[model samples]
Target: MKFLWTLFILMALMHTSSAQQTQKPVLHGKNWMAITGKPLAATAGAMIFQKGGNAVDAACAMLAATCTMWDMLSWGGETQALIYNPKTKKVIAINALGIAPTGATVAFFKNKGYNFPPEYGPLAAVTPGTPGGLCYMLANYGTLSLEQVLAPALQLAAGYPIEAQTANSIERNKDQIKQWPYSKKVFLTHPGENREAPDAGEIFVQKNLLQTLTKMVETERAAMKAGKSRKEAIMAAYDRFYKGDIAREFVRGCQEQGGLITMEDLARWKPLEEAPLKVAYKGIDVYKLQQWTQGPAMLQALNILENFDLKSMGYNSARYIHTIYQAMNLAFADRDFYYGDPYFKPQEPIKGLLSKEYAKQRASIIQFDQNNPRIGPGDPYPFEGKANPYTALLKKRGYEMDTTKRNFAPVHDIRNTSSLIEYQQRLWLGTTSVEAADKEGWVVSITPSGGWVPACIAGNTGVGMSQRMQSFVLDSTLSPFNVVQPGKRPRVTLTPSLALKDGKPFLSFAVQGGDTQDQNLLQFFLNIVEFGMNVQQATEAANINSNQLWLSLGGTKNDDRKPRPGQLLLNNNTPETVRNELKKMGYTLSFGDRTSGPINAIYFDWKHGSFWGGSSNYGEDYGIGW
Candidate 1:
């Protein structure tokens, strides 16, 4: 009897572990729900649904909790999303990204002789959009009071056990935290001692943040009772944050600390509604987050991929990887040169850029033997004789160029050096300064306080405001015609996307990594749509990335910096069998990592009426629920 009991206990332990690995939540009875990333966030959403709130209400609640727990990914500094509405049966895209203060202008920096700064500070900081976005959702679709939705975040903020992932992410961004006194106080001790993970059941607290949340709930309630509709009341909360006493104090703090925000900029900030970009792939309608992100670029890549037989090429095969890289390069050629806000200027249609005719034309140019020194736009229309001027120019210029003529030139040559030598040379001479200037940037924010900040400095009302600053980096590197202009939003890579199949939503997804966003999204989409894999398997699949000129995974580099192009770095991990086969076909191979981007998604199946959500376990995170 004793032996049997021990066997039963061991079996139970194994079962529990297996269940965790494959676990998913389910909601039945004509409604579906799930949220990826944090378990606390999922619970918060579920609680809202139990209270008769729809998807919007649940999502708002989830957003609040995420803000409290997943500070690295969710905060006022990030963007917001709303994918579907049951009532309207229409998709809405909200631009919750922060913008620069009104005083921010290219001329301001040019006059100061200051190039763009490398990190987020008051200068790089835009108006936060999370608060306004949350209020908008609540006013339009929520039923529960803001206070109820925010309770979880407020509680979590007061204290929750520290996880290993959270600690690591905090440490990585320690430099950024050091800039803000409040951030330092909340995240670190006097000497910045590294704290160990809390015991399994311990609770932690964030007193300052809790106080901030409390004020917002009280202020929102008062405004609603005093002759304001839900939406207006929500807007009033935002106004209080921007135009009221709160703005004064925040601005004063900025002034004292040499920050660049003003009251007028806060007053003028507003969120815009934009039409979503849609595409058809294999008879299925696919949607993207519109011009606010690189959704169009993802669409372009997919359209180009439609021309290839990726499955037959086998998983992670060099031939398969090379073909995809070439296709991506073709797509990005147009993106880097043409894509931007359509409201301000007409964006050249990338569909033509990735058409079947164009793909064939570009594919024909791929040399399996000696690497081509440069890659061009190829023919935009293979059937027609209309030449792509971009391709012709690329051929004429080659890839390599003398840097002395450019504004920032390479002062020394450090080629064929060891890793340490390269690092030192890079730090000392900065030959790659121009190359360094061309990378992507992103800011993510989550707020559980119901689209408002707590009243620590706002005098008892709880609302926060965001500035719109993502517009600073719009235009092509090659074309002066595409320079940043007034009233134009930047070409962003931020996407909060969801995938649907067989008339049901299959994935609630988004990737957080600048230029790598679309590349990550594309790989995940393929893993599910073509390979028939589960969420975790698909997310963990090997990935590849290309930013127009250089393909990172493949063993070649198509340099955009010079006239003579073709240089690549192949990952050593690339399978030898695949490499030999590709080499026979004249392709090179290099080694790379799987760290393209961070993905968060919830997968739901209608047949089982079950929901499964998962965040990247590779990063700092916490999953909790009952």
Candidate 2:
């Protein structure tokens, strides 16, 4: 009788836990679905869809709207996307991430006594990429004209009611905004008033930005008048932004503010469309961008986790958490060292890093009893039939052996450490995601970032300069692949994902968080495939985050950006038993009510021939489906 009672209670507890995953209802649609960081931005995508646009056109509109709204990014920001084309039956990557301008070499920064590039202002700027990226995507895959696609963003540039999140951000960072003359003129509406930033719900206007966008549209219209093809017309607009008067003003503004961008830098840079990398996990194939971004870290993690029976361990179980955390750290360690620009360098051993044998070799070092604070990058060259040239450097840097005495500071100094962690969280917190899908089998997943608020506006263009230069490292000892160089792209945290099953689109997903992007994405993917959760549930479901890898953003000093291994973030509602077990395994735990980050995704419901959209309740992420 006692055994029966205990079994009943266990079942009841499991049911209750499962019920919590449905905090938000699953969004269903038959024709199309558009989801992004803000409701207004999603509405922009929907407007395009309602006007007979496909997923690509809608996605470009959403990207423009988000950039105009300063949804954690701006016009000068970079964009990274993965698009699943139904006609071609292939997933293509958009490498619109900005490159370092001339004079942005490691020596240039090292001469300033800096560990990494500066975090903000014109000095931290990279050449803008989003404008050309949107134009390229629209011209190649979209059916609409450039002017038609940019209507919503042009309206936004004219004026819109600013949200409190953005208004307050400007107010909080007003001191820094004042450092740049153009930014001061555009952001500080009240000038000498105590509250210079626009108040929440106030109509915010950018005349200069509106004019700049108008110039692009006008160029497109003029090109059409000249009997140019649609693609040629769009390319004309791209030229105006890069090599024309807009570029001249942007360069003038950038250089006027102690920036390094030259006219040649803007004229030379162009977005690339390349084949994406993929790895098969179970029966499903997951695709990510090249090694330039951290997208492959998730692929590596999935390959490693494939060796274990994760479903058998149950969701959020202490053992499951430890396994996921370990696999993520292992993958990220490789990312910190090996992932960078493919166009530069001796090249990354990507073939070996994504190999099943390499995954198994990395997985073999995992110890189930306690966290491995000294987890480091693995040697992948052997699997690709090449010698490991960095073996000596790895050993010299103390990453070849386990020498960590403690992963957490002593209890007496916990408060000071907490303050630094809070700052680190802010640094790792930016970017917004876009996910859109249509009944025609077109899927788009984009993680666009850089040029966040308090941004330094480059000249009279009213476009914020990219702060992406900070993502580059000055010392080759840290990441030989990611060392700063003129015209080279930095390894970034923005990653978008796509998955296919049985030769069809299965899922398109992305999230807004720095280093935590892939960590949340990996668990979200598992929540659906392994745990049988609906799209919405998978997005909102509680997941753990591991801070055992190097910081990818915001630190002026090397020590400030060092990894804090064994530090784990768990949902506050985690069972006491699970918490105790994790504690026993040497995890220094932190709790949050929401830890999944803001994940936006679209799942193609093949059986029903519909679309399922998921927008996490963690932030302002929203979706519109019809």
Candidate 3:
């Protein structure tokens, strides 16, 4: 009877613990705080600030520890960072994007019978940038050496309890993982026979990754003994992967498998640091990564919306949400058309795209009565002094060019039957973000991606290369962002955000959804700036649909692969009447779920000498200030 009672108690405890994972996170501190997708990593970052490390050091440590989460980020992945230095009053964009190999030409894939690189495998892979990025942060901006910054990640890689989400990722990809012996050895319980992912709450240990990191640590130590400076010693560790053994193995893997990467590519590849693409919005200056990623999509959306009274549109009302989605679609269309690797197209198109006049033209295209059948790219070329042809088209429809609008009274019946099939909500999360602000007025935000678990492992180096090459478009008809070429980093999707007010740091934020990164962050910002929600309220708010559209090749049942128009994902909180009204506008609407934007945000209220932090469903995220 005593044994039975003990078992009953254990069961009760297990149930209680499982319930906590679903609860919203609540954490705030004053004096150096770190918040990330994982709890341990957040704490690890906080620990660094307490140890007298700067925001860059805390963020570097946090990013390193974040590599343990294979579902979100990997040790060998692509990474981008935005650092704000108060003294210099400047923001730096780190383009730690993995580059296509010297041999990754369009002909190579055309000969392989693929329209593009296969979504999986070494051919889709690029040289990872995560390690080199972390080391770059250490050598340039950080106060701690790589030996010190790498400690938390090394500790976690040695042994840490696996969360349920991570275990599920391992199990779902177990079949693909087992085919690669090195991957089978690292992520599963045992090779082949016990190949399933470990049960959740299991103590997961990755000795292989630990060994790889320890070798770098050893290199750092050796350099220190050889009389290297702190930064030089840290870079010695960094060189272990870029110019050393790991780079050789990575190149060898591609060579053996007939993939394109080479050691020379790795050796010459350095993370690019440049000034941010700054855009002025509502008196606040917003900064984002350059043209390489989709960061500009957010800026373009804000610029277009600035023409309208977004505050007047009741927050989250059907009309308000529709306006936002319409603006998003317009921005995405521009992104597909104009954005690309600035290195290839040295003349970035931002000068024309972000201009207030350009935005006025785009905003004028939004029709509120009925959803646009499809919104594609617009010509942002110099709009002659004469009104744009779009303005003329609206005037022909008896609409004015100014904000005092008329005629949104339903041109076509939305309830009219159009053969449209609904899509299931997506569950793809292949990247992670981290941010930190020290009491000393330094801020950092980074989005690290590329090294997903079911990816290339670089010939036993345990370095997972990115399939980010999939983001490239083979044809340049839409934009030069297309047209793959050797020695070019494909246009990427890792967008991080930083905001400044009155020349002072005001916000540091990021979200993790490939094409949806800009979509979600744009909405979250509106939720705070326009809707007046606090940090936590803004985070837990629902995202509009991410897979709500596809390009419309031909609008019929036969054209499902192309863009589907007027789809919205809403939950119960959205009134039934709103759904009916949207449907009446001819939209293909779905319910029961919304997009997952497991986001975290930190606010730098320097004026008040405090910070506000909030995140969606929590495992290890917090916002603290000191």
Candidate 4:
């Protein structure tokens, strides 16, 4: 990021302006609220709420606003969400993850003499699902129309300040954007010369994106005058992107650039409405997305951790960290081997993968006195004979183990590395999340990602493909997650969490990063639930990552051999005594200025009829409530 150094100088100046800095997170009143990666986006959602929209509407608006600003998170990408419908008194998981093209078979890339598509380009993209997913959320549960919720984003695109976050991302990805002519035209130009990043507070206009959004509005208007209902009018825009001319435009762009997406793939696409993968931890019901993401891994880790007395061990203690790491190792091993699209038979049964009995069986192996550094996937499958051998066979074919590799740079401000999108962030670490709740008890938690690195901008449309295809592997080995098939969604890492206490909504939270997302969430949960940290304290607390051997979704091939459970990155803020204790237990460790996972959260206090909200100071996180 070229402007990073400049931004740092400016940031230092801001810090000096205040006599003292308080680490405590911000507070909010008991009313509707929205929290996200940027103050501007949060304000956009808050505006929707002020205008009489509900949580669903506010969250979707926030998501769109974030997408317009952060190319690293989404322009076109996957948006996975968890919505709590107060009317139904239940949580719903919206699997708005994109899918592989009908033509994206393993042999297609194999013949090209590559292990997979290059990290970022047209070939790496999947059909984009962000718009479609937002449309669905609005049409189904939201009271506001698409035009209403997206109004802020459209206006922002017309002319908005280039905040530090967006400026940094564009600077970091400038070279790559230059490779695609259309991408270059839209993101990298300044009338006559090449585009330079707009300074933090300077205005930046996205005319191309503005035009694209305008077209959607125009298409919607045409549908309405033609007698289509409001829902139908929204669908008209969705259809244009997924099945009409816009779909063909993407197909055309892909074909011209040696990519495989097609009209059939886009037309056939529709975000799925599924039950959340739910689990109970210390009398609270926690809901995360299904296996299509690593959301369930949090559930698995929580299940294993339940067998221990965490409070007795004390938070951030060696015992606590080790137990959590071991549990994460066991859970992530299953994630690599078993988590995938069940629709394609990812080998493991959904019930068995999340069963408490299975968790107990896996948890029984942990030794609190020592570290279990590198255990592979345990037998989550109940029926030995019935278990398929696909994943096992593929391992024999030389894919090595799929783990997130760390090409970590020297310790620096994490905000500097914020340019990374979801997968690339597994190394540098990043993502985008939004959580909003209304006075009516309706709430939504979502993680939106892709359309940067592993993704390339589509031709002329100002939209890009989500690099979710990088999450999928191409082989007959039946790697639950990597295989590609027509309409098969790649297993993603976007997970949002919701917790209910006493059968009532108590908390909504999410984080940005690849595998670190769950880890971040886990730390926050314990920070509040066990250590009695307030929402702000939990949000600001330093955390660690179990990232030794793991490879991220969209991860490229790494020649280096890594240890199982990998090396741990300890946040110095957690105390050196605890770090030394973990090393004594045989846990390898490294250090960083900040934790890998950056989180935003909201806690509902039914006893007081109020809410507390907190956002990360790490980078873009901002919180607003009333």
Q: Quick one: best TM-score, which candidate?
A: 2
Task: Name the TM-score of candidate 1.
Answer: 0.73
Off by over 4 Å in 3: 1-26, 192-195, 383-428, 546-562, 592-596, 618-626
Instruction: Give per-residue CA lDDT, model 1, range 279-328, as digits (tens).
Output: 66676556666554556667777877876788887766777767666666
TM-score, every prediction = 0.73, 0.95, 0.86, 0.89
Residue-by-residue lDDT tens digits, candidate 4, 201-234: 6677767677777777888889889999888998
Each prediction's Cα RMSD? 10.2, 2.9, 10.0, 7.4
- For residues 129-191, what per-residue lDDT tens digits would candidate 2 score against the true structure? 999999999999998998988999999999999998889889988999999999999999999
Compared with the true structure, all predictions reach lDDT values of 0.50, 0.90, 0.72, 0.75
Cα error, residue 443 of model 4, in Å, equals: 0.3
Which 10 residues in a row give candidate 4 its minimum summed lDDT? Answer: 406-415
Query: Candidate 1, which segments miss by more than 4 Å at Cα?
Result: 1-32, 111-115, 171-176, 192-205, 346-373, 376-471, 474-488, 501-506, 547-574, 579-597, 608-617, 620-626
TM-score of 3: 0.86
Residue range 204-312, candidate 3, lDDT tens digits = 8887677788889999899989999888888888888888886787778656755688888888788888888878888888899987888888999899888888888
Ranking by TM-score: 2, 4, 3, 1
**Of 3 and 4, which scores higher on lDDT?**
4
- Full ranking by lDDT: 2, 4, 3, 1
Q: Which pairs, if any, clash in model 2?
A: none
- When 1 and 4 are scored with lDDT, the better candidate is 4
